[model samples]
Target: MHRHTRRTVITTLLASSFALSGAVALAPSAGAAVPTASCTVTPNASGTSVTIKGEGFTAPRNLNDGESTVPLSVDANGNFQVTRFQKNVDYTVLAVKEDQNFTFVNCKVVKAGDTSGNATGNNAKDAKRGAGDGYRAGRSAAQKSCDVKATPNKNQQHSDAYWKAWQTGADAAFNRYC
Candidate 1:
């Protein structure tokens, strides 16, 4: 009787362990991949404000508001992740960057893949731009281009389209990172 009781107890334990393992195996993974942005912030002595710097900052443009400068989104590598998310039910996150001279703002609006942990859509041209002084120089160049584009009667239709596209991508970046 003792042997039989021991056998029954062992069997029950094994069954319970197997059940638990199966449940765990069937459980859902962390479905969404966390979107990461590369940014370097230099804090002041009091830590109240920071000098935020990154690449892929572009000017915003619209029919009424033409060529206003704003910070574009970046990926894990600090390159501008230029992708648009268009779903009314999606999430929105605010990514604000400010300095003595300018402020870069992005309100990231999420899309299906943006939250799925498997989405891959970043502008290759904007990626791999460098950090630190190189970043500043590149940013200056980009701002210069924007400034040039913003000039009165100097507009190209394709240039306008590009700026508009950059402005649209801010929604996804702000949602994912900010």
Candidate 2:
């Protein structure tokens, strides 16, 4: 009876190990890929107030809010929480992977009113270009370019279609990154 009990235990352990190994196979190979990271950024009454909630901040780093970067301190237990996010801007997580030596983009930060609502779109970015320093270093340049079409052999020249396409991409990029 004792021998039978020991044999049963050993068989069960072996079978479990095989099942566990199979699960590992389902996961990406070591250093071949970065673990998919995810997070959510919540803001307080103040737009600048933010909290970052997620996992895998292996080595705590900084989070950027377009205008500046802020240091992010992760808890010893691997929990990360921040208390300030830029108002009306996009934010994202940038972290270095323990393996693969690549930065993992677990998620992007976003807020309403970051982009323009115009059919032409980019009206916000263009406004930002004029209202503040962007693209051409300030709002004036962006406004001038709103009606600008290409002049052959000159810099910043493109077709109306090109500009429209650029706006589409710009909108998508902000949505994707932020």
- State the C-alpha lDDT per candidate: 0.34, 0.46
Worst 10 residues of 1 by lDDT: 58-67
What lDDT is obtained when candidate 1 is compared to the true structure?
0.34
Writing each residue's lDDT as its tens digit, candidate 1 over 67-110 gives 23333444454333333222222222223533211232333322
Put down candidate 2 lDDT per residue, 1-178, tens digits, no spaces.
Answer: 9999999999999999999999998877532423323445555545646555544455655566667766667566444666663545666665644552225444344343222112123233443433222222222323445444222221453322233334434433333333
Cα lDDT, model 1, residue 165: 36
Q: Relative to the unseen true structure, what is the Cα RMSD of model 1?
A: 20.4
Model 2 Cα shift for residue 92 (angstroms):
2.0
Candidate 1 runs further than 4 Å off:
31-178
Model 2 whole-model lDDT (C-alpha atoms): 0.46
